[model samples]
Target: MELVFVPTPGMGHLLSAVEVSKLIIQRDRRISILILIIKVPMTSSILDSFVESQSRDNPYPTRLTFITLPPLSNCPDPSSFSFFQTLITLQKPLVKQAVTDRISKVGSPALAGFILDMFCTNIMEVADEFMVPSYIFFTSGASLLNFIFLFQKLEDDEGVDTVTKFNDPEIEFDVPGFVNQVNGKVVPVVFLEKEGGSSMIIDHARRFKKSNGIIVNTFTELESVGVEALFDQVSKNIIPAVYPVGPILELESKTRGGSQDESQDKILQWLDDQPSSSVVFLCFGSMGCFDADQVKEIANGLEKSGHRFLWSLRKPPPEGKVGMPTEHETFVDVLPDGFLERTAERGKMIGWAPQVSILSHQAVGGFVSHCGWNSTLESIWFGVPMATWPLYAEQQLNAFELVKELGLAVEIRMDYRRDWKTKKANFTVTAEEIENGVKKLMSLDEETKKKVREMSEKGKKALEEGGSSHMWLGRFIEDVFTNVASN
Candidate 1:
């Protein structure tokens, strides 16, 4: 059987899709994966290199093929129109044509189904037209998916106007399977009275219901309650079958390639010289970075914490360069005066570091993360506790789930926000706050470390033979083929 996996044009989404595809192929040698890459402006070089490396390293390279869709004729600035919105509204036709051509040449039966990124739900129509099943690949955890489904139902039942009017200072909403109320702020900003936010979410929800099933990049052991919620009768009819086959993280060899550049080698050497569990690894996701003021504050915090540190700092993008990759240089200008010299003995600051390798290192005990789901899973997989600093997207929710629900992470600033128009209108996470968070995380209270280690073990075991995730993947494969055969 062959599957066409459609990934959004972002690093996190692309990586998850690729990892899941690899899992599927490994589980069933007869199955092959064809990745449909949607070309977009503001691509990540890291993403490009990762994809190239996957093809090179795969034992059965012939089982995978990557096809890039034609780029948009005149791509608009991503700030004005999000890549998600543009892909849904404008690029659907081009993508449909590409898939249609491939299917026509290969014959519909040769392709088992479509596996789509959550953001690429618009392509499900093509699946329907071809009379084949399509599944949604949620790149985040089960809790976020459950919340999104419940949020949609609330809006539909209560009326969009009524739902949009909720402006409580700290509203608490209940979703099944979670023990506590989800903080209102952690909900997506789009669901809260933004002009197009509600409609977009509702539309995605509607599209999600149409898919045959969902494959989430989280294991059952880590989120049993949230995973169970998706299967509840109340949701079973609306939400499709869910397959929790993950902690499907980037492979270590692929992540830590043999051909390390000079800078990566230096970072590795530094790590090798450090004591086991003595360093804190700090990295924001691809889109995360702090302004000059924030950078200085972080430097101060690291110094005050007095812990060995390895910080990957990126330069903030220029004004109006939203979604553009920002360049990073040495900390000569970005850090505080003499900060580097003062901490030279204990800290190593780099423009970029191999995050997977760093997280996997024994010397690294804790993570200061932006709490993107990919980063969250990576931290969990490596048994690294986190100092959570949520920036945007569902990171706030992930932070809440980590610190509040799961007791797996320490909190930094869950309520930090910035007004893009007014550069100064932002909440600064003070140096003191950063220092406390880092200290608490690095201290590694025995209980938190124990919990993280247990979850880490469970995550790994889930991918092993006869594990929960392994069984789910097998069930998903059988269902896909069975459903098509019945049709």
Candidate 2:
């Protein structure tokens, strides 16, 4: 049997899709997988390197293929959230051709299913054309997943548009997966808007109802309430089945798993020199960055806090471009004057970090992170406490869950949203806020840390043989066969 996977372009999104593809191939000898990669204007260093290295490590050469789709030249434009949506939409014909070409080969496995990334829901039409089951690989947490569904539900039942429903930013939404009331302002910015990517997101949420099911990148033990709530919806036939086959993390990050270079050695050495459970590690997601003013505030805060730290400070993208920041140095230009010199002994700012490796190290105690779901799961797996600092997309919603719903992280600012079109945060997080968040993060109570540690173990067990995710993986595979057979 064969499975076709379509993934979007962001590094995090694409990376998660790769990991899941590898996992499925490793688990099922009966299944051969082909991943259709959408070409875009961004970095594919991690994916390219992983695919190259797989030739040696992979036992099933014939069972796996990562084919980059033909480029979309119509736009000749840069990458942004909304632009990426348009980019994916324009590639529909390319996607159909890729799948058709593969299935028509002389001796290929039987076509079984299509695994679409959240943004690639539109490609389900191709699956419909082929008479195969389609599934969505949801890359974020389950609470946000539930909220997206509920947002659409409310709009339909209330006869109100998204923006008007979110008219009062102070109003709290009683979403099922969340124990705490989710504030309207803290909801994903996409959910509050009515056009562009927001429209696409909502349309995807509606499309989700027609798919075979949603395959989440999270484990049941770590998100019992949310997972259970999703199943409740299934019991009522409100949506398709929900499969929690995850905490599917890349345990060995690219740097640690692939090659060790000079930078890796230096990062490890610095941590090796620090006291156990003393250093605070800060990394925003791949797209995480701040303006000059916010960067100065962070520098001031770290200096005042006097904590041993490793900070990954990315320069913002060009003033108005919709893109991820490149590796930023020249700290003297944006950081508080003499701040680097004064904190030189206690803190270090580096380029992109080896996050999983650093979190697994004993010297690291806390994470001040952007609460990207992948980062959040990575922190939980390593038992590192976090102070949430959300940036974009559903990240603010993820931060709110970590602090308000899960109690797994300290609050830096739950409602912080980065405005991409304009070059500003909805509000600036001051140096005082950063300092205090750092202080609290380092001195987190043993109880909260203990809870995180417990969840970490559960997360591990969920992926082990006969565990929750393991069982779900099998179940999803079974459903793929069953649905295809029925069709």
Put down candidate 2 lDDT per residue, 1-487, tens digits, no spaces.
9999998776678778878888888888888888887776555554566556655566677888878787776864553446767777788899889888988998988889899998899899898889898999999878888888887786766765777777577887689987878788787887766656556777889889889999999988877899999999999999998889988787756552523456767899999999999999999988788888888999989989999999988777777676667753423468877887899898978867888889999999999998998899999999999999998888888888888888899988888888755657888999999999999999999999999999999999998899999999989988887887788
Candidate number with greatest TM-score: 2
Each candidate's root-mean-square deviation in Å? 2.4, 2.0
Q: What Cα-based lDDT does every candidate model obtain? A: 0.79, 0.84
State residue 221's C-alpha deviation in candidate 2, in Å: 1.6
lDDT of 1 by residue, 396-475 (tens): 78888898889999999776654332233237888999999999999877988999999999998998998999999999
Predicted model with the maximum lDDT: 2
Clashing pairs for predicted structure model 2, backbone only: none
Evaluate residue 204 in candidate 1 and report its C-alpha lDDT on the 0 to 100 scale: 81
Error of 2 at 14 (Å): 1.5
Total residue pair clashes for candidate 1: 0
> Clash totals for all models, in order?
0, 0
Ten contiguous residues with the weakest lDDT in model 2: 252-261
In model 1, the runs with Cα more than 4 Å from the true position are 44-46, 106-109, 160-163, 233-236, 253-260, 325-332, 418-425
